[model samples]
Target: MAASETPLRLSDRAGAQAFVQNLLAVMSELESALGRESDGVRAGRIAEAMTGAAAKADLAAAYTTGLETAKANAIALARFAPEGLEALKTAQRRFAAVLETNQQVLATARTVSEELIKALAEEVGKAHTPTVYGRPSHSPSPYGRAGANSGPLILSRSL
Candidate 1:
């Protein structure tokens, strides 16, 4: 028979397993038949054909089982719908918004603190100066020079 004219066979895990089992049974039957045959050449040829067919069936069975396992894994992954991804995206957007707000508040606080320090330094400059070793000296403001102090300290007082 021509290769194209032959019927195509497809098998899954269970079908492949069944095919392998049936092929083994057929091989046993063929061996028994060959033993009964009187012509040695015909018997040897039949045994060789049976062996080749069994090997092909075994290879096909392995391929089918591998395909079935891959199909099952793909199906399991598909079970996670788009909704899960959408929920994760929504959470990420909310987190981004919160982070942006925190950054804005920090920037505003930094600007206000800088202005407060500038105003305090100007006030201190206008205050009285002490004499140290016959030279003029003044008590340094906790805010330091123009750009010093690491950060502002928040002190709480109970009313």
Candidate 2:
């Protein structure tokens, strides 16, 4: 059989558990960051900041979950493989690669999210800004004072 195909000996259960525990810890951190982001958004100020935080949190959470799943699958392979050692090693490498890919994706997501939020905030601010013929006014409507034209107009006729 090719060396690549040969199975590897399985590591101790304790080692697998340790790896899993580490993955869970990472996941927990990601969750905490996401929670903070949500809270910031709920506060309703500093929208751009909130969006950036939320995006970071989202990407982190996704990466953590993905890496956790990959680790779990690797552990299962270690348990079931007939050629234990080789299979375990292969699984471990595969899981590591997955983790790396997830990290890259997370980073990209964070960047994109931040930019999107900033652009949205800018657009909203522009849309809501008051327009004035003279000095700026805080009135809701730009055209004139509220109820100014509510009364009927009087007309004078000259023969």
**Worst lDDT window (10 residues) for model 2?**
150-159
- Runs of candidate 1 with Cα error greater than 4 angstroms are 1-81, 129-159
C-alpha lDDT (0 to 100) for residue 120 of candidate 1 = 74
TM-score of each: 0.31, 0.33
> Could you tell me the TM-score of candidate 1?
0.31
Instruction: Write candidate 2's Cα lDDT for 27-129 as tens digits.
Output: 5555455455444434433354355565565666655554544455665535644354364345556556555554555566568667876787666555554
Cα deviation of 93 in candidate 1 (Å)? 1.3
* Clashes within 3 Å, all models in order: 0, 7
State in Å the error of residue 48, model 2: 8.8
Can you give the lDDT of residue 100 in candidate 1?
Answer: 56
Window of ten residues with lowest summed lDDT in model 1? 34-43
| Tens digit of per-residue lDDT, candidate 1, span 1-159 | 235643324234454344434434543443343333323223333344344456545544544453344344333323433333344335436545544554465456558657987887655644445567977565576866532422454433221
